[model samples]
Target: DTAVSQTPKYLVTQMGNDKSIKCEQNLGHDTMYWYKQDSKKFLKIMFSYNNKELIINETVPNRFSPKSPDKAHLNLHINSLELGDSAVYFCASSQASGGHYGYTFGSGTRLTVV
Candidate 1:
């Protein structure tokens, strides 16, 4: 079983359009997160959810939203996609209630805006 999976490994779209990417994990984890890796390779946390509750990271943009239906799934929705949104989105998960444990990330979903 795949521990974590993200769809549309690559996505190209025009600015002003809305798009979404799906993610799922089979690791029986209770927490999931969305991270953005910009061209410079800086990894930034967008949102984190544990048991469907929001744990927003202030560094992220308002246009980005993360939704988790359960512990095993987290999806990202981007509104009014902009050139600045051109980056790789990674879905990650870790054991619930732990901080020392590292997170497992998906290969990545590269979003290109034109």
Candidate 2:
């Protein structure tokens, strides 16, 4: 079974459109995160959810929203998509034990905005 899984592995849309990507994990982790990999391959944390509570990165725009229905699932929604938002989004899960436990990341969802 996959430790973490993300749906719609690829997304292509117009700049003004809205889209959402779903993610689920069977690892029974307490914390889940959404990360974005920019064109330059810089990875940045966009949002994090611990037990369904949200902790968003200050640098992320309001247009991006992350919702976790439970500790096992986290979904990302982007509204009024822009070209700058095009990037590979990754979903990851980690236990409360910190970095020593390491994290499992799902195959990323590549979004392209025209």
Candidate 3:
């Protein structure tokens, strides 16, 4: 089984459309996160959730929302998607206490807004 997985690996939509991407991890981790990689390949964390509590990254836009329905799942919803929102969104999970350990990431969801 995949340690982490995301749905709809590719998404193409028009500007101003709304879309959601779903993610799940079977690593039994308590912390889950959403990251966005720009065309330049700069990766930044957009949101983090620990045991269903929200931990927003100040830099993220309000249009992006993350929901953790359970410990193993984190879903991202973007409203009024813009062309700037186009990027590869990655879902990752890691143990809450292991700072030295790296996160297990999903393949990524590529979203393109035309």
Candidate 4:
């Protein structure tokens, strides 16, 4: 019954550790996306997947990789996490309505690197 859920709601790790955050949605949406909110509260589109195909936005770090097993799930794997990588990662989904409709976001996973 959760519309969207992300595990490891809060993560605190060393500067060079690797981490993975899992996300799943049961809303039966056609598209899912990952957005990173910076310290300044600027939300940026990181990666998007639909139908097992990827549609990335701007240039995200190579260390950040998104995997979508199916339309219902998209997981993010980060390698060599840095202090700058510490941010609130949100997983969202929207019905395929040409991006006009709003998206439903998960509670969010907060990652803190020390």
Candidate 5:
């Protein structure tokens, strides 16, 4: 099985709707990250947490929230979705000690806001 997995690989919803993407990692890592990739393939870090604690929250909109129920799972929820929210969201995990290597990534979730 994949070390990291994300459900709802593809999501299509209308504007002003709310949706969520779930992610889980069985790598026994301590850190997890949420990333977004735009049409031009520009990847941006949206949120990150270590040991289920919020670590880094880039300048993402308030509508985007990341929740970690435990060290092994992290989920992204978006409210009042807009067309600009269309993008590929990726989930990743790594060791918190080094915080720089051995990252296992999930097959990404493509979200489209129509």
Candidate 6:
């Protein structure tokens, strides 16, 4: 069983189109994060929400947004998609306790713009 799951493992859209990726975690974690992996395989943190509160918001474009309906879910929405947006988006959940952190990651959603 997967601890974290993301829908539509693959996404393809045209430029200027809008798209959304959904993520959910079955583990009992309070913090969830969104990460983007570019073609070169460099991972960048996009957003992190903890216990229904916005904790960490990285330097991402305004076109990218994170929406969380609850603690276990965080979705990524992108507007006016461009060719440069093509990459793999990952959703992960982590737990922080006593200076120790444990993370569970989803399979990731691959977005391609053309």
After TM-score superposition, the amount by which residue 102's alpha carbon in candidate 1 deviates from its true location, in angstroms, is 0.7
List residue ranges in candidate 1 displaced over 4 A.
none
lDDT of 3 at 59: 84
TM-score of each: 0.94, 0.94, 0.95, 0.95, 0.97, 0.95
TM-score of predicted structure 6 = 0.95
Largest lDDT belongs to which candidate? Answer: 5
**lDDT of each structure?**
0.90, 0.91, 0.93, 0.92, 0.94, 0.92
Error of 4 at 33 (Å): 0.5
Best first by TM-score, ranked: 5, 3, 6, 4, 2, 1
Candidate 3's displacement at residue 113, Å, is 0.1
Compute the lDDT of residue 52 as modeled in candidate 3: 91
- Tell me the spans in candidate 3 whose CA falls farther than 4 Å from its real position: none
Clashing pairs in 3: none
Tens-digit per-residue lDDT, 85-108, candidate 4: 989999999888676888999999
The Cα RMSD in angstroms, rounded to one decimal, for candidate 1 relative to the true structure is: 1.2
Deviation in Å, model 2, residue 4 alpha carbon: 0.4
Q: Which digits, one per residue and each the tens of the lDDT, describe model 2 over residues 1-114?
A: 989999989999999999999999998899999999998989888898898988656478889988888889999999999999999999999898556787799999999999
Which candidate, 3 or 5, would have the higher lDDT against the true structure? 5
The root-mean-square deviation over C-alpha atoms between each candidate and the true structure, in angstroms, is 1.2, 1.2, 1.0, 1.1, 0.9, 1.1
In the range 1-64, model 5's lDDT, one tens digit per residue, is 7899999999999999999999999989999999999999998999999999999999999999
lDDT of 3 by residue, 17-63 (tens): 99999999999999999999999999999899998988766487899
